[model samples]
Target: MLNFSNNKLNNEGRLRTVLDIGCGVASFGAYLLSSDIIAMSLAPNDVHQNQIQFALERGIPAYVGVLGTKRLPYPSRSFELAHCSRCRIDWLQRDGILLLELDRLLRPGGYFAYSSPEAYAQDEEDLRIWKQMSDLVGRMCWRIAAKRNQTVIWQKPLTNDCYMEREPGVQPPLCRSDDDPDAVWGVSMQACITLYSDYDQGVKGSGLTSWPARLTSPPPRLADFGYSNEMFQKDTELWRRRVESYWDLLSPKIESDTLRNLMDMKANLGSFGAALRRKDVWVMNVVPEDGPNTLKVIYDRGLIGTVHNWCESFSTYPRTYDLLHAWTVFSDIEKKGCSGEDLLLEIDRILRPRGFVIIRDKQAVIDFVKRYLVALHWETVATADSSIESDHDGDDIVLIIQKKLWLTSGSLKDTE
Candidate 1:
């Protein structure tokens, strides 16, 4: 637990951001944010490396790479200061070149520092390594300004060299999971309800919390009564036709009619078949609702006592089918089979080992997470993905599950 108390540098910018050089289990970055950027350099030692869940929880961006790698990822003159925290001597020595990159990433007149606990320097070598860093910083126009028991602050002299031609921040682009099977797309199926429920959230990404005042009262959504899935099938084709009609509105400009025809077909499909993404935006947001009022007479009759959750809050349902578009509907049906054996198979395809998934039970569509999705696995945040319009009616079931993991490379012990 390192503490940051630099008033002089923190005072310069209206908002302050820092890069935690070797931030181990230490998320002080999320706790402190004056304004901008806070990321962890890509180091495998950090168990949570590439863990967007943690970063998203705190609104911080995560990235990969060792310091001083050829070009810095950020444009020159970006940060007011560069920070390194809880990194000791062994790691510091190997990352010596990284400090130069940090200095290079800093704004014209920025500061760099490293912090640790009171017992930060365990041995004489740790003190010697700090001296080595101090010397290097001095040669590069950085001068020591302040020092506490285990923290040292250094300032890089104001220079145009830092402003002229630095590359962008070494941050990776947003995770586009459709292309990568291993990486998560950050969207969920159950999460899509609230999105489409509204006329605007699907197209514009406005949250239900911000819906117009007049439309505050909730209404019948897709999952109120129970699971039929037939409705999803019908809506799929409807969305496809609508998208195809939309594409026809645009003039033809392609070289090949065959490709054009394919594009036309995909356009109707919606998610994968989506064309002109500008018109429709794919979305993901926190929490969801599977509405109960939208039920038909048959299943709605059985939904008497189960619609609500343990919390007993009628308004806190997790109802809403995100995207009712064709491609999403088809995929949901194709991939996620009904519970039991099919459920396990679908779960296998959708989740990685140790990866968790949120499932919506077809039986009782409750608004609160406590209703059903929790029994499967969703103890943490629920997950879903789709291209259909989402609704926030609070009727969707949240199924949380983690993929199973197994040990590999078992070996005999060396007892000799």
Candidate 2:
């Protein structure tokens, strides 16, 4: 163990995000919630029929994904820890490419906790694997932080010193200078180390504050996007008012316990989810692939999200979210030569039956989506104008709708 304190984990809660690879039923993530840590539990839809499904059912954040040929739909350096416990992944396959993927996901000085037979088993095969994995991570500039029982924790270096000191012509070489670490959508996993930036190389860890403070304070990465603290504060205040108005519309329509899993389809700077911290819901903040790379900003704030393209389906099972928030997502995709109707269908597939959707966009877009409500089995709950007084355009609208709890003929025979 890392000898964490009673009140906080390492680095005064800077170590908040976790990537639990092959999380069976997400029990690890479930236990982490009590400690103010949020883990993005990932598993592929394979022999494990419904592991991610069960995790979502229990209100834990999860996604159906794997470290395969394609990159995981997340920006680089998003998690403080990457964990795999008896997950049955071949770390040494394809020249340790799978382990390199973890290296890309982890932040500077991040930790990877491996609990597998190779760590404790003494058989010949296990020993060979353990030796290879050890050498692979050693070349990748990772050191054993702790090893006990069946677990061996490795910590990534905080600077590029170890990498620069490596011998020439290493098997797994450094990524090309032109490679973008944050470019993950539809990208392939490369078998190379992603070096830290000039700023990150100087810092000890991610220049982030503690959890609650990090939530409100302007993150250090804001400067990377040329965003000012004033802008962050103004955005935060705007979302505060908008969320209050949203609760006013939703409070009367459903009970308090109705919503647990939520998704912000077009999260900008993640202010919307930040404003909802007091609620008992966990929001999957999504930043479009075409937009600014603010997913790192979202992570620095102690929140979780992924980089996605609305043109494609989200990486999750059907009926995974209890509520979906769309702030001009349909319009943004429309501008990209994508169909709004198809986006609506994808939304319907992910939203749970009887779930709620709040769409805020111009009047023309709202009218276009309204035409499909009947065919989609959704009913309008409320519609209102934007609360901002400066919106003199008089076309901005907020349309709230609820997905009907209807069943098809296939399930009609099911009766208790």
Writing each residue's lDDT as its tens digit, candidate 1 over 121-144 gives 667866676666665565555666
Lowest lDDT sum, 10 consecutive residues, model 2, at: 387-396
TM-score of 2: 0.95
How do the predictions measure up, each by TM-score?
A: 0.35, 0.95
Per-residue C-alpha lDDT of model 2 across residues 1-416, encoded as one tens digit per residue: 87766646545677889999999999999988987888999886578737899999999999888668988877888899999999989889999999999999999999999999899867998888899999999999899999997799999999999999988998699999999988887899999999988878878668778888899899888888999999999888878888888888888788878999999998889999999898888999999888898998998888999988999998888998999999988889889999899999999999999999999889898999899999999999989887543333256799999999998877887752
Best by TM-score: 2
State the local distance difference test value for candidate 2: 0.89
* Colliding residue pairs in candidate 2: none
